[model samples]
Target chain A: SAVISQKPSRDICQRGTSLTIQCQVDSQVTMMFWYRQQPGQSLTLIATANQGSEATYESGFVIDKFPISRPNLTFSTLTVSNMSPEDSSIYLCSAECSGNTIYFGEGSWLTVV
Target chain B: SQQGEEDPQALSIQEGENATMNCSYKTSINNLQWYRQNSGRGLVHLILIRSNEREKHSGRLRVTLDTSKKSSSLLITASRAADTASYFCAPFSSNTGKLIFGQGTTLQVKP
Candidate 1:
């Protein structure tokens, strides 16, 4: 099992500002992922945070908007740049430990005004 | 885009009643997992059923996966008010180790 922690639990930011959410895992994990959950919706994978290389983002998402950095096996950061009202969502960080079970952080709730 | 779709987006039942939720996916998967989220907070993994397995049980929760139909069902027996939350199904890809989540079903277990 993995214990995940996220910083800035809830924040209200103005439009056009950027916010960086940090995720820290208790143990080194092979896979780390970022997901976004809009109001009253399911989680959408933002990107896969690779340890030593660029992140792999899903379709409809790009590095320019959601830049991810995975400096090591236990730490990663996701930056929501040039934010807008549409970017208001809950961002979650999850890590896959062992092989099957995935653990999630409390999540960072960002509200753009 | 997510790979699964859950039926009965919302459910309301008594605390002692049982609750059942179903999920259907479009693609082949290595395993299917159930997760519960409380009021839009973090997600807690409930149970996981591999493609080769048909049914699995964890305490009061029972999960069944049918690979032939690409569907799965989760049953919570004798639920409590604490069980009120949104439930989601995630299809895991063995090749990539990625999980795709469905919309989710909101269960309201009134005490």
Candidate 2:
């Protein structure tokens, strides 16, 4: 198991602005992922953060909207650009550790006005 | 696209009773995992059952998987008020590291 942390545990942002959520892991991990949980709904994968390379985004999500950066094994960031009320959701960062078990950060709850 | 769907979107149960949630997936998977999330919080991993295994237990939680039917169930015994949260089932594909999450079941345990 790994200890994961995210910054700005909760934030209220204005529309047309941007907020970047940071995720830090206690140890180096092979893969880091970003997910969004819409209100009253399930999680949707936004992208996969790969160390030293471009992130792989899922369908319905774009790099321009949700750009990701994984400079090292233990750190990554996801920025939601031009925020809107519809973008208000709980953003979670996760890592796949040993035995293929996944661990998640406490999550960054963003509320766009 | 999402791969799993859990039945009984919302459940209310008394403390000390048992709560069960069911999940069904579309494709074959190497492993399926159950996770719990408090309102407005991130998810916590509960347990994982591999395709080759039928059932697994951890503390008060039991998970059973049927690969042939592509479905799974999670049973929580002696539920408590603190157990009130949403539960989700995620199936990980062996080929891609992607994990498809279910719609989730909201369980409210009354004290």
| Best-fitting candidate, scored by DockQ | 2
Summing lDDT over every window of 10 consecutive residues in candidate 1 chain B, give the lowest-scoring window: B1-10
lDDT of 1 by residue, B1-111 (tens): 337788889999999999999999888888888999999699998887889999999999999999898999999999999999999999887676788887799999999
Query: What are the runs in model 2 whose C-alpha is more than 4 Å off?
Result: none
Q: Give Cα distance to truth, residue B42, candidate 1, Å.
A: 0.9
For candidate 2, the per-residue lDDT at B49 reads: 91
Which candidate has the top score in lDDT? Answer: 2
Fnat score for model 1:
0.81
Model 1 chain A worst lDDT window (10 residues): A95-104
DockQ of each: 0.83, 0.85
Off by over 4 Å in 1: none
**Relative to the true structure, how large is the alpha-carbon lDDT of every model?**
0.92, 0.93
